[model samples]
Target chain A: MRIGVVHETAAGERRVALIPQEVDGLRKAGHEVLVETGAGVAAGFPDAAYAERGAVIASATDVLGAEVVLFVRAPGSDPTLADALLAWLRPGQVTVGLADPLGAPAAAAALATAGITSFALDLLPRITRAQAMDVLSSQATLAGYKAALLAASRLNKIFPMLTTAAGTLPPARALVIGAGVAGLQAIATCKRLGAVVSAYDVRPAAREQAESVGATFVDLGLDAADAETTGGYAAALGEDFYRRQREALGKVVAASDIVITTAQVQGVRAPILVTAEMVHAMAPGSVVVDLAAAQGGNCELSEPDTEVDVDGVTLLAPTNLPATVPAHASRLYAKNLTNFLKLLIVDGAVRLDLDDPIIADTLVTHDGEVVAPRVRERLGLA
Target chain B: MRIGVVHETAAGERRVALIPQEVDGLRKAGHEVLVETGAGVAAGFPDAAYAERGAVIASATDVLGAEVVLFVRAPGSDPTLADALLAWLRPGQVTVGLADPLGAPAAAAALATAGITSFALDLLPRITRAQAMDVLSSQATLAGYKAALLAASRLNKIFPMLTTAAGTLPPARALVIGAGVAGLQAIATCKRLGAVVSAYDVRPAAREQAESVGATFVDLGLDAADAETTGGYAAALGEDFYRRQREALGKVVAASDIVITTAQVQGVRAPILVTAEMVHAMAPGSVVVDLAAAQGGNCELSEPDTEVDVDGVTLLAPTNLPATVPAHASRLYAKNLTNFLKLLIVDGAVRLDLDDPIIADTLVTHDGEVVAPRVRERLGLA
Candidate 1:
């Protein structure tokens, strides 16, 4: 199998789909890797590093001629680039990467029309066996880590307590809203920095997960027994429940020095957990990092990729935070891709095994049709 | 004693000499506290907060009319503002705070000409008894912590090592040059962020201090028996020794993902520990923060208050880092001032006793003369 990797053309997108270490392993498995010029440069992996691992350096068009094409962000994720990318694709060629199948199902229809077998990595199943191939989890970890770091840097005081000859300075208080992968990571990071950390989640089972990460779980006295779905993701609750939750969380937000909100619902607008009034109630010199800014924000004041100052408080809504820490993000993402490829290619050829849950769950378009039922339904196809 | 606090007028200086917490104590000590309106506002202390603590909010001129005036950065520190500040002072008036007496001896001379009793906290002696009054140590601690945080935030990779389902991502390597208060703090901060930290110092005794803070001391194999002065500070080493030291440190600098340089020689230029060539040899996405940027940086390529990118590596020389974390910085600084005021004011009146070493050491000008020996020598006064 000849796998191709192209440089990401999206502004501020620095991650590479395949790194040198992953390319080395693929080469050892007898797969020829073709990387476009400077494909991994922005992610700290230069062309020389990739070439050193026996990956051939080639032009974008030449690399696109391979059997399998890998992308950090599939061109279909951007409607403007979808047509240009589809024009370059040939029938029977396989495309693999995150194409936002749930959010932009029209991209799946476009891929189907182009007769391209597309596997949207964003649609990977949440089963334990598929955890290694979960790009969302890997990328979310980086986002969580970066969010804590960004908040710390923007904060007016140090996170940790200090007992000096002058006096004792108390540790900062950090509140993490949402106990999912990103929220847990943010809690752990804030705790590591010596902050007194607490967390809240809509799902009751997330209490243990939050506690395991060293955060004192906050019980908002609201019934959320049906707040979780069978797939283990948060389900949207009633407006009244959210209103009451916000009212209960107002005091906690006011007392906190740092607030990191990561309450994102898959394929939908992120729940607004921190209101503008709550932000206004927060003490001066407080920092709020809204990780769900790209998905309509968990904070009412969040503007995607902007740092706003409101009455001495800092509100940072940085989108695609993984791109800021590109090296580690790309490394973890490449590893996820490598694991997925093991089930994707067999004996130097593309093999479609719908019986495998991983393949069946991730395959969005195949044989000139949108195959993934959820994506098909999202596209309103009969 | 009527003590006055004024807002810092220097550019980028956000700290105030006294906070509401300190003002409250002074008020209870039979001292009338007068604060310039908006003095502590930038440091997160509102006028209402100070008023609640029994402080009088007044104009800058009214505050300066008190018997003694306190400043975060004395007007003498800025040449342009010195004359205007001096014109407002009476002959018997007293001034307190950091005036850079050693760096700008002319400031001391001007204070003498104005017949004002000036106590330059920057000239505070390094002694066990005077530890509580040491402004340099307190400010340096904030600078160090901010340096590490800035470096971590600027780096393109996360600091901690993680064994995830995707793969194990290794921790970043951090190297701190100069094991002073600032450097030790930086090492501790980087370590808290889970980076593998190492420190380097010319003084051999600094090895223990570095290790105490969880940093592996890097020995560059350069002889430095004269590196420590009797006053317990780094001494200016010969140019030949610096050349050899930089040569030996080149490889270590190249291997580090983050480098924080805090080396400084009092009353002189800071030593350049990391050369531009060494920074160039470092991996792409590496960050170097020069904490001694105000004293002519410890990195060869550093420019005060600027972020310079050499190839793909970032070199940040942030000046007055304590100002960036103003709330805590002001609190710590206020505590140090409170301690010093204990010795400066006896029985509700200004008491200048040259017999006390703490008073004698920090007094740069008194009774129409440049009294500090070092300041007199620097000013070439008879």
Candidate 2:
């Protein structure tokens, strides 16, 4: 199998699909890997670094037309370059990456029209066997870590308490809202920074998960029956439930020096958990990081890619935080993609087991048809 | 004694001379406190908060004309507003704060001409009795903690190593120069964040200080027989000695993922430790934070309040980092000033004992005469 890697062209996107370590593993498995010139430069892996790991340096034109094309983002996701990317593929060639299939299912139809077999990593099943190939979870860890770091930098006081020759300073109070992969990571990181951490979640099971990460579980005393969906994501509660949740959370928000909100329902607008009244009640010099800003922030005052000062409190709504820590983000993402590649491609030939749940779930388009049921139904082509 | 506090007029200065917590103690000591409106607003304390603590809120003019005026910055530091501030005070009145008298001795002469008693906190002696009144050490601790946080935020990797489902990530390598109050705090902070830290200094005594803060002391193999001055600060070395030091430090600087430089000879130009060629040798996405940027940085490529990128290595030269964390900076600074005031004031009357070493060392001007010998000699008025 000849695998291909190219430079990511999205604005503000700094991660590369395959790093030198991943390339070295593929070469040891008797596969030839082709890397585009300067593909890994921004992520601290230069062309010479890849060559040292047994990868052949080639042009984008040559790499994109290989048997198996790998990418951090789907080339067809960008409409301006969709046609050019589709034109480079032919029948029986495989494209593997996150193509925003849920939001833009039409891209799957385009890939099918070009006779390309596409496996969208975003659709990987949450099974035990697929844990190593979960790009979303791997990237969420980096996003969570970066979010806590960003809040600490913008905060007006130190995170940890200290007793010195001058006096003693109290540790900062940090509140984490949610218990998903990203939220758990945030709780862990804030705890490591020596902050007094507390967390809240709708699902009762999340209490243990948050507590395991050194966070005190915050009980709002409101019954959240069916707050979780069957797909391992938070479900959208109606307006009445959310109003009560916000009202109960006001006092907790006011007492904290840092608040990190990470609640989101997939393919739906994120719920507004932190109201303006709650923000106004918080003390001056406090910081709020809304990790759900890209999906319409959990805080009402948050704006995507903007830092707003709401009456002296800082509201940071940074979009695509993983890109800021590109070096480690790419390393973790490449490992997930590499694991997926090893599972699908065996001994120089592609193995598409139609009956396998992992294959059936992640395969969005195969052999001139929109294959994945969820994406196909979303495109109205069922 | 009627002690008054006013807002700092220097640009980007956010700290207040006294906080409400410290004001309560002063009021209990038989001192009438007068505070300018919104004096502590930037430090997260409102006028109403001070009033609740028995502070009499007044206009800037009323506060400036009181028996004694306290400030975080020198009223004479700003040339544009110096004359206006000096005109507001009468003879026999006292002013206390950091007045930069050593650098601008002419300001001392102007204050003396007005028959005002001036005491600069920067001249405080390094004695056991003055340890609790050391504002410089208190503020440098904040600067060091902030420098580590800034470096962690700017770097394109995690500070801690993690073994996750994706793979393992190694911890970041951090190097600190000058194991003083700031450098020791930086070393402690980086260590707390789980980074591999090493520190270097000219004085041999700094090895234990660095080791106590969990940093490996780096031996650069350079001679520094007289690195310590009588004031307990790193003195300026000869040009040949510095050249030799820089040559030996090049390899360590290039290998570090984060470099924090805090070396500065007081009242003189800071020595350049990391040259531009050393910066070029660092890997991409590495970060260098110059904490001495205000006095001309320890790095050759640093510029105050600027972020320079040389060959993908980021150099952050931030001036007055304590100002960035103003809430805690003021809180700690106010405690130091409060301790100094307790030592100087007796029976609520202005007591001037010229023979006391504490007063003799810190007093810059008294009764229409430049008093401190260092400033008098610098101004050619001895």
Q: Per-residue lDDT of A1-382 in model 2, one digit per residue for the tens?
A: 7899988887778888999988878998888899999999888889999999989999988888889999888854444448778888888899898776876788888999889999989888788888888888888888888888887887778888977677898988999998898899888888877789999998887999999989999999989979988767788889999999999999999999999999987667899999999999999989999999977999999998888998889999876788888899899999999999888888778899878777778898888998888787888877
Chain B TM-score by candidate, in order shown: 0.98, 0.97
Best by TM-score: 1
Candidate 1 displacement at residue B202 in angstroms: 0.9
Q: DockQ for each candidate? A: 0.83, 0.73
In candidate 1, list every pair of residues with a backbone clash. none
Residue by residue across A1-382, what tens digits does model 1's lDDT show? Answer: 8899988887788999999988878987899999999999888999999999999999988788888999888855644557778888898889998888888888889899999999999888889999999999999998998889888887888899999998899999999999888999999999998899999999999999999989999999999899988887888888899999999999999999999999988788888899999999988889999999878999999898888988999999987999999999999999999999988888877789989999999998988999999888888885
For model 2 chain A, the run of ten residues with the poorest summed lDDT: A75-84
Candidate 1 lDDT over residue span B230-328, tens digit each: 999999999999999999999999999999999999999998888989998999999999988888999999998888988889999998899988999
Q: How close is candidate 2 to the true structure, as a TM-score?
A: 0.95
